[model samples]
Target: MGIFPGFGGWINQNIQQPLKTSKRSKNGKSSSVSEEDRYIQGPWYWDPDISPKEKAESMEIDHVKSMPLSATDPRYYDLDELVRQNRLWNSEKKHPWNGAPAKVKVKTKKGLCHLNIDFTLGSPPQSVSEMFTNPRNLMYFHSMGKYKYNWRTRLDTRATKVLKKDGPRQITEVEKVLRWKILGYNGTIPIHLIIDENHQKVTATYKKVKVKHMKVFEGSWKIQPLYVDQERLCKSRSRISEEQYKKCSGGKGRIGSKVTMEHIFEPSSLLNVPPVSWFIRGIAVKVTKALLQDLREYVITYNKTETVDPLVYAKIKESIQKEKETELKELED
Candidate 1:
């Protein structure tokens, strides 16, 4: 039988009787709480009265002191090792997500399993003022929404106004600005999604991308510094006579005296590079009851009971020293 689309493939295959246990509570009492309530139970903000900056600083200090090592190496996440350990743990666990037993399929590849997390709440921001409350969600929305297509709004109004006073120059500058905005939106989101996938961290950034010019131009185009092209002009064919050059000064001084061209190029072009789209994505290892309690208790107790164990201590030191040396070598190179 084919598994349902939205329900994960693994969950559908493993589940024999989905409604039986889920229909009733563990103690055979009716389930009072909703599934949505479980996810929303966590504290959203850490006492808003105390500023976020101060709270984050305190948390940072606490986290640093809590970990054994000053920095935990993300590179040390061994898939095979974690899978073996997780499987062993899973065998003894009873997962809470599903009332029945749950298990994770360990693949040879590290990131083959998909962890799709989506909230039912549609398009987070209720108003412009509310945007500040949820930056991460807002950032993702902005990148995907207004920021991408809203380039004209972001342009420096003072600069655009000054250029507009010059008639023909205004048209050129406006067109250039519009082109930049369209290109900006096209590339920002897609690359950001890729970066989010790789780093396992949330970030907001304008991603520069390369793309084939379709409507705007005939071929591939790229953004570049203006001077890079302007500086390489071939030998001048028409030399203005000294009198002509001097006449350009309006008789105040020597010709061309006030014509020393210095282009303070604050110019940026959002060239139509390959288009990119952005999305909010994340991964989470579900805490489940699939594991045996005795083994689970042993692992947690082993780490907590003894502050300093010789064998474990040796292994930790060896890993840290090796890591330090590797980092040092990279720095030296």
Candidate 2:
């Protein structure tokens, strides 16, 4: 035999045989692979055409995509009827005056509360990222005076690091002190937040900053592009004629940013007075919804009045196009 077998048979046995092996035993039983092992074998060993760097990047993308968007995400929360039946909860009991988005959900467990909020801004991802990263814009949106939070006053604000580059991510951390008048209690609260930005996503996490009225106050904010599903695009195109689809730029969906915010905190005052939990939750819900709405409005207004630099806008647009293309390719494959 030539090298143990003919060329075609040897190739099949040596190259493709392992892939065809059932992930089961001869007893017709299924064998589960550990996540670590699967991760190693799935992308690293399977795709020989991809370079190591490309494989790493693809894994990173998959990881980012698989991250939990919120506590309410099905990946983390069970939607079974029994699970829902045992729960004691109320959602959207009090709507904010500015109107809350449908994606907002508030959940309370024991004495702790969580808010899962999702919204979309009118501007592209780059513009939204710029607005969030800029201190001036942040102050304008968050300062008590700007938002007219009569019950709260900003005492001082500081940033340890405005911006630092780590590999492909930009990191920033800020601290603020605010005086609050809640339930006839006057106290100072400190807030600390760290923001990390890569090319495709921005994540903001609140550190364990001490606050007089809060035992625990921490959360995360994530912003990424909202990708239209390929199947949806195909259906839309099928509905329209080819000429019409071409005129509409092949029915390419409008590019927008998807923002997800998760807030988990327990106010000392609220815990001290269990009856007022509902009141506190209402305030938190209102404030969170109002802030999201304000940000959305602000981005729309900013885009209308200000235009990003030609070169910067070009780069942002190109990055967005690349993301869209990648999403489409993944769907196709």
User: Which candidate number has the best TM-score?
Assistant: 2
| Residues 1-333, model 1: lDDT tens digits | 001123233223323322211223456555544331221111021211234464445444322122112011112122222222222222322321111122333221221222221111110011111121111121212222334465222111111001111111111010111111232332211110000011111111111221122111111111111111111232223544433422443322211001001101111133222221011111112211111122223233332333332222333454567789999999999
> What lDDT tens digits, residue by residue, belong to model 2 across residues 226-275?
43222344445244443353345443433346777788878785454656
RMSD (Å) of each candidate, 1 decimal: 29.5, 19.7
Q: What is the lDDT of residue 187 in candidate 1?
A: 26
Model 1 global lDDT (CA atoms, 0 to 1): 0.22
lDDT score of model 2?
A: 0.44
Off by over 4 Å in 2: 1-102, 138-157, 162-164, 177-189, 196-199, 227-254, 269-272, 306-333
Give the Cα lDDT of each candidate: 0.22, 0.44
Per-residue lDDT for 251 in model 1? 23
User: What is the TM-score of each predicted model, taking all chains together?
Assistant: 0.14, 0.47
- What's the CA error at residue 136 for candidate 1, in Å? 50
